[model samples]
Target: MSIDFLKKYFFGDVQSSSDVSSVAFQQSALRILLALTLCIFLVSEVHFLFTAGDYSFLAINSVYLAALIGLLYLSRRYEKATAILFLFTLVTASILLLTLSNEFHAEKYALISLYSLPLITRLLFTFKASIVAMVANLYPFYLITNNSWMGSAEFLDSANLLTSADALAGASIAPSFYFQMLTFVTLNIGLPLAVSRIIQTLESHAIKMKDLNQKLNSHYAMYEEFFENTGTPSLLCDQRGKVLKANQLCRHLLTGGIKKSLAHSNITDWLTPAGENSRFAWQSDMAECTLKSDSQTHINIRRASLTEHGHLVIHLENTTELKAIQQELESTQETNSRLAHFDVLTRLPNHRHFCQQVNQRLAEHDKHVTGAMFIIRISQFKLLNKQYGKDNANKVILSFAKTLTHKLSDQAVVGRLRGVKFSCFIPLSQTYLIQKNLSELIKSILPKQITVEGNKLNMEYQVGIAYYHTDGKNAEALLERCEMALEYSNSVERFSFYNNNLENKLIEEHTLGLSLSSAIKNKHITIWLQPQVNASGDICSFEALARWQHNGQYIPPPQFISIAENLGLLPLLAENLVRALVETLTDWQKEHIHTPIAFNLAGQELMNDGFFAFLMALVTDKPWLKDRLELEITETSPVMTHPLVHKRLRSLSQYGYSIAIDDFGTGQASLGQLVDIPANILKIDRRFVFPLPHDQRHVDIVKSTIQLAKSLDMKVIAEGIETKEQATLLIAMGCNTLQGYYYGKPSPMTDWTSHSNAKAKTLRMVY
Candidate 1:
């Protein structure tokens, strides 16, 4: 075999990268001893064959050689098993040598190896194994050496464990025996224990050294990687702030992209006066500093870390973008604040900001303080809008606002409350000062004329003033009180002060408006029929009237009608009235009553899209309704007077509705205005009919109205005939129909529909 192969077989490559030793020294020691013992036994067996003619000893040695070769073949793969078997092989061979020494009566030198068994066991294995080998060797040695054993003297005398001749003679045999016993104990127990302890200490120290070196290498690699490529702008510096090493970010930040090396430059030199105030320093806890460049670059020290070598490493962040963002945020906040408080068109403080300013001014004084808050309205603004267009009106208002701003004191809080209305808070803190502002100051400040589209328009205004203490307690209350007073002002008076009576009037109107809206929505307003009969008093038709019984008190028609018209709720009221009329006519038609029912329509109702569409849809769906449903327009509304106003009524006339001009004599209709009125019937108003048959002035007026209706080929119905005489006089005056309490007063439709025949018979006596 090659020397390398032989060496590998005897001792495999046992060095390992791991901390644990790859090859146990005990296994190696055991393998070497087994090889040596096998060779010696082979030689001894050959001697036995040649000298003693024992051929069987050679066969026995062949088995031992085979065992040695087989164990060596598996030793590298199974180290623990091979090592234990090899160790025991040596023990068994030693035992065999003793046996041969006793069997052949050979010298004591054959027992030499047995004495070294304890020391070999200690070197190859643990102390427990050494103790076992020591005991095993002792038992066999006693058997071969004791005096009482058969032929023990031949084995003891001839076998010299000393290996040197004449060391002990026959006379010194006992001393020689003592000497051999001493050698056995020392080799088996004493020498093995001493070497085992020394080996253990050296192995432990070697392990600690290896761990320290590995930790040092790991720390060095981590630092090297972090310092070179970390994203943060970082610098490695000494205590004096000299740049030792810098990351790529830091190199670009201070050294112009690393083109100029910063090996010896001080980082502190870049600091402006503000940044110079916070010098970088090392501390046990994480520290920070601020710095600025010469070019107004903002730099912030995020952290400063101390390295293992006691050097400082500072990480910086650029905050210039964040500073710009902060400034932009502040600008946006300021703009939003102004938008929240000021008017978009005029750039003036709105109601909310005006209230705040007023309260602020009032808070500067005590409870005794009193001033004036005026609710100023631009006079006839809506009229101006119709005359010159809304765009031109807006320009006029803008000019007025600019004039007020120039003339009013800075301390005054003047704000536009809503369209065409402005509020001015004059915090004079005295009654005389408020009067001065009112009598001469306001009139002189506002110009008498403001031009619109190069045309001079007269400037006029009305003011409603509310003073503190007597009027209200705060700005909100004061402004509300001023509005209450403004409701009482008219064009003649031009101004009014808040009083308790005005507040009561405002509350009454407010409550009535609410109740009127509810009544229209819920159909609570009852439609009453005032029977209009022919001259014979037979019920032919009915004039429908609206009535309301709210809170067990009757509300007059005139009171609620005016309220409905003013509140822009006339369409809703008219809708309810028409529904009542249609329902009554349908029920009467079922009873075979062919009388037509007429309900009044405001001039504005025909123009309202929702109400007009509803009327058209109803008529279209029930074509029979057009013959029964009659339309009455009050003459005072200018529907028959204005040419465009009667056009819608004429369309209705063509649709089979008998249009009537109601309240005829009272409408101020001239002959020219009466020429084009599309009327199928003319009803003389109650005012002219009330004094009929007695008052000569009304007699002539009613006669003339009836003659005018006759000439126009229209039927005449005299309204409000309360007495039998008035009804008779109206019937004699060419009146075809007469309606009044003389025949039947206004009652709910149920009363007339249930007893129409009986009521008509009773009303016939009046004629």
Candidate 2:
């Protein structure tokens, strides 16, 4: 149990009683005192107890010796052990002072233990505490040495036990001995003061030096953070260009997203040979150099050395794009000069260049050699331009130029003369004239139709021929002869050679145009109704077409319409067509037949104030006309997009008139037009409908148009559906309205029965 107690007492979490600063002094004093008490004072106590026959003191000394062994520890954790040892020694000394050291009698070891209390306290505690110990010990010490305070017989006995004959020799700490011990006190106190002064100076220096080192470390840490976060492409390297540390941008610029180790990498690896050579010779503290990288990029590099033999910071600025921009400015004028000789619309040679080259060819030809000049003119081009707008007209001209160039050989001269006309000069090289055999070649070129904005147009043209050396000498004279031939072709409506009888053909055309104006005034213009059917073969509506049979000859609609536009008779034609349409629908109404009829309206007819008022007044009183009337504005109307024209159409639509875009998918038609215009029906043009179920591109166009109409809550009608297969494919693609000649051709109103078609609705607009 004692061994267990000693083990726990020395090794457990014990607390120290002394102050933190004096703990080392307290422990050292306890160790030295414990050793001496056991070696000298403890041994002397045992001898004195035996000699004085003091068995009580001997028993107490035996227990103290037993406790001293257990209280001692070898480890440095001796705070609690030191406190317990000091307290135990003071308790033992007190016990001896109270029991053995009295006024009458005292034991010798007890007197020695009490006198040593001052010395132990001075070593273990502060000097003030030791002075209090000495004050307390003074009374007990005096009691042991007081000779008269004890009886003479007892005093003599105590003196005889200690081998002292005189009373002064009875105690070891005598008055005379204290006086002598005081003589050496000055040396002991002076030596401790001298050593304490030296220790104070050393501790003060250590504190200041420790603070200085902490401040230096803080400044270095801030410097490192600033170096790593520098914004430029900076690097820390030796003067020889061996990289130690580089900022993030510098690493990424050199390595291009690859994570390469920093060890032994040099800036010279990415430089060109010239740049690498320049870097080796660089010596200034700061220098600017233009370095070319291996990637062929120019870099304006600026470098500065941070130290005499360590680290260089470099910044790279790219100058490749700037240099290229400077070079482009030098060549701009040459490009402009070359472009000046070509036509802007078609990029073909202009009239000036064409004439100059043709005159040169005439100069080169021998007197026997011959070449022919052919001038080609697009028919009704004025109407074509008015119907489809200038942008689409430009597309047609450009397409014509490309097709003409593709058909002819490279040596043949082809050029755009001016608006809707082109010239080609083919020279004859042999006795057989190529000009006489060139009609078949011209026929082949004519069949290659021009497609403008997805609508394919027939390339109908009239070509006038004039032979060089037979007609005139140079380009100007040959062109004049060609123009005369062109005038004859315009009147006769066929390709013509140089002729002198051009006025007779013009007289005949003039007679026919006069007959057309009389037909409009005399109400000779008539309309025929063609049925538009749905996918189920049920009739939806009828398209009203203008027809004329004058002088027992059938004039095509396109031929007469172009003549009417030139004569300014479109409004008069529109008035006649509307009257015929009402008559047809009124006759059908009396027969109990009802179906909607639509007709084309040109932009010129809609914008005429007098005609617009007449049409609106006719439908204003007849409220039932809303169910039977539908107005179809031609998609190729020249002024269809004008604000006043759109206003008129929208007013008609607001009055419950069914409106549709006629001949759609041509001439600037787009998805945006369908959304913005106030129309309910999008009629697909015949060009797209004619190629359906065969041409994949046209099929996709029809399919997408149907989907777009359905998405916008509009009905889609596809015309020119000639085959049942085409109708079935359109129905499968989500279109229900279909119309074409496969259903029916345009016929008289009396031809349709009351049961087969209940009612025919009329929507007439003059085109």
Candidate maximizing TM-score: 1
lDDT tens digits, residues 629-659, model 2? 6778787766777789888888887788888
Q: TM-score of predicted model 1?
A: 0.56
Q: 1-767 in candidate 1: lDDT tens per residue?
A: 69877565556544533343424566566667667766776686667667866566566666777787777676657866776777667657656655553553333444556667677767666778778877877776686456434453454345444333343345545775677678666776677667667656656665775687688778888887877778788887787777788878887776545376878887766543243335543222333333434355666664466779878878777776887888898989978888889876777888999899889888887877667788888997898999999889888888888888788887788888889888888656454455545656667767678888789999888878888777888899999998988877788877778889888877887899899999899989988888888987687778888888888998988888878888988898898889877876776666566677888886778767788678777778888888878888877774445555667667676766788877776676545546666778888888888887889998999988888888889899887888888887777888998888888888886676566545533443223
Off by over 4 Å in 2: 1-511, 587-592, 641-643, 753-767
Worst ten in a row by lDDT for model 2:
758-767
RMSD of each: 10.4, 20.3
Q: Please report how far candidate 1 places residue 347 from its true position, in Å.
A: 5.2
